[model samples]
Target: MIKKLTILATIYSLFSLSGNQTLYAQDKLEVDVGGALRFNYNLSSWKEGQKNRGGDFGYDMFRVNFNSSYKEIYLNAEYRLYSEAFGGGFLKQGWVGYHFNEQDEIQVGLNQVPFGIQQYNSHNWFFNLTYYFGLEDDHDMGVKYLHVDDRFEYNLAFYKNSEELTFGGDSESSPNRYSYDVVGRNKEVNQFNGKLIYKFGDSIKSRLGVSAQYGGLYNLDTKETGSHNGLALHYEMNVQNWNIKLQGMIINHDPKNLPGESDEILQMGAYGVPYEVASDFSVYTAAVSKSIPVKLGPISNLEFYNDFGYMDKKVDRFEDSFMNVTGVLVSAGKVYTYIDYAAGYNHSWLGGNFVDDFSVGNPDAKWEARFNINIGYYF
Candidate 1:
């Protein structure tokens, strides 16, 4: 069993440009520890052998999270363990934060980047297509600042690089990471991010935001650095128990490769694998879901959703890519289960060799589908 503790600490006042926040001499430190265990079962249309064997079911991951706070200072971290085939084990995120006041705060260390629809843009376990391009739910070693108000939110961050102390590989850019990033002959560096969000509405609350990223791409062979830029617009709405999301983004990576290397396609890697991706592209995604109260004994609620994304490469000869997922989430006490059916065309994770699908995709390749179920229990 995990232990929870609250201890008295010497309080310190946080001074800011505006004023000083007074803290009592005696403040209590609050700590909470929790985690989850997950499992997965999947059947893929592209895997004939897997279908013949009636699919596969196995352990997915085990993770632990720690959070503590005292006065205006706080810290949180998460570590995860997965099967060796999925990159073994690594720290997801660990950061220390401080509150200048109720509206302003700062975080330092490994933290999620401020971008797009926030922690996630899709409801399914697979996430949205933007995740593969390093635009959604991406985390890096950096510093972050946040400002919040009644109707607006602002985030600014500077990331020196991705988490380099990952599980596998001895190279400068390791593939055993939780998020996709520039790997192989190039790496991401000196990245800056900005996001602004506005909230409004009476009966139907809505939020609209824009995110921007600018970074340098360092080519190992040439020892020269190039640049990358990305811009995105995201919107979400909640009307009663119904939810909707829409997003669009454009990304460009210009790597200064060696004389013989082509810059048309850049390499991105994660989860102990590398794949090719188009250098210049635009992505659009839409997702919707509705929650319904359930009375199936232990079951409490059900959420049904559909998510879709499309990628349009700027290169004339490159083929397009798309993914669609329909799923349902069942919540019962501490256990949550997701049943999903996903289909993709020219997508990397979905099918078709799983290598150059995001680059010059196989135009002759047919769409592939996968049936998946993921269940997790929280403590």
Candidate 2:
């Protein structure tokens, strides 16, 4: 109840101030509401020798975004409804921000952690392996400072807690789940994230950036404490209608105390215990995309893309994993679609093989392929 009241108060204060300021200069006030409706059909190969066989239609996502601005003050929020069995309405993002100048801004509340490429460059709606490791398109509650100019961009942030977790019988993550950050541990305490990027060239510009994250990982079971740190180097370039990107990252999760001579590792993410450990792992990704002129019905543009990714874990009997995705995107006004074919091997933990279900007996060590299509409209 107290938390709810505080959130309400903050929202009320923001609106009150915005309304008062906008009244003085009503012409500067702006309000916009937008959202998307998505549908998906997937054909997945579960085992080593399987054909594309299941036919299911899902009302994947319905999102509503609201944005209001009055001079330097702004409010941005989005709510989403998913069609999954365990789905309902939730806040995807909400923030209040103040702009000091064209190049400087500060935002408070739940915002995206400025890590890795945002929104991702993937044909699949699920993104890639980096998401599972909390490296791509992840959000947290924090205060963020952003500075962007002609040559450089800077992002510095501090977060109170990590992503929210659900518990008990109705919990999104149940016993021994293998998706999302359901470990219930590894809460962020005074977490700090910083990123810097440099842009060069004119027609063929290169975007290069280095990012780092460091914070405490608290355990819910033992009330013990741990720490996790990550470093990444990312580079992207666009030439004509073609765009290319590459990223590499190293992450370490170190427990404050470990049993003597235990030789145990603290694993994170959907892998749960015994598989994911308090060790270091590396991920590398590369992707290329090109826009081509194509007209099919209302489709006026098409984009072809390929994404390659690999992850290596330093554990015995655990083979390295890789994913290769090739697909095309079709666009027509507010309508967009994706047709992708993805194949992978030995990425039981870090890839799409474990995406839908993370049960104990699920096939994780087998080769798999999937054909996915997503259609959506913005309104």
Residue pairs whose backbone atoms clash in candidate 1: none
> Lowest lDDT 10-mer window, candidate 1?
15-24
* After superposition, candidate 1 runs with Cα above 4 Å error: 1-3, 10-26, 166-170
lDDT of 2 at 313: 62
Residue 332 in candidate 2 has what lDDT? 92
What lDDT tens digits, residue by residue, belong to model 1 across residues 116-160? 997789999999899988888788999999998989999999999
TM-score of each model, paired residue for residue: 0.93, 0.81
lDDT of 2 by residue, 171-276 (tens): 3222122223324333545689999999999999899999999887665544677787889999999899988889999977765544552222443453232234
Q: Tell me how many clashing residue pairs each candidate has.
A: 0, 5
Q: TM-score of predicted model 2?
A: 0.81
RMSD in order of candidates? 4.7, 6.8
